[model samples]
Target: MANTAVRVRLTRGASEGDVAALKAWLERERKLEALRSSGELEIQERAGTQDGQGQARPMGAGLDIMLVLIGAAAPKLFDEVYEQVKSGVRAWRENRRDVENGEPPEVEVAPDGDGR
Candidate 1:
């Protein structure tokens, strides 16, 4: 069985931005298409996390597509691939100036009240 992208989020140590970057890179690199054709793109199986919120982005790697399970992959691994995605994203934005991506807010980050 070939290695396919599994729907897993990066672990606590993983960087969300990094993972995103990798996906963008693969898309532009044309790796995503190849993975899809090879049946390696759509076979992600994310692992568990401790933050209790590791299921937002799909995190995985291979071929044409990139997966980030919001929050379930290892941080180190996620960062590594994310850099690739970032590169791709840069390439795409540079080529298509008019294109704009507005990602909706998924998480609500609010700090607890601490009156000093």
Candidate 2:
């Protein structure tokens, strides 16, 4: 693996609340929690600026659940994390009544670039 960090993000046709719920759901995974506790994974929220106050706020369209791989063990741990995340997304999607209304949920794994 490259020396740089790898970022994995999950996105779905969601409302802001849905994004938050998905994040919470993923956090409940035992393996993910353990990896986080060990500093091998990092979770981040993607938000947009509020119109007037310039404050960061979650947006539904592009809101994503991002995992950053930062530790030396990340290569080995990557599969475990990916599987857990996939399971979480699957569970989340199964509970949505409008699962067929828009694009399906997806996970993207890419090089950690400029934090975007």
Clashes of each: 41, 0
Q: What is the TM-score of each candidate against the true structure?
A: 0.29, 0.63
The 0-to-1 C-alpha lDDT of every candidate, in the order given, reads 0.35, 0.60
Task: List, residue by residue over 1-116, the lDDT tens digit for candidate 2.
Answer: 33233343444444666667777877777887887888777777764333223355344445545676675676666666666777767776676536556554564544443433
Model 1 lDDT at residue 78: 39
Give the winner by TM-score.
2
Please, what are the lDDT tens digits per residue for candidate 1 over residues 1-116? Answer: 22222332233233445345434445446654454455433322223332335344344221122243122333333343444445555554454334434431122111111101
Reference-based lDDT, residue 31, model 2: 81
TM-score of 1: 0.29
The count of residue-pair clashes in candidate 2 stands at 0
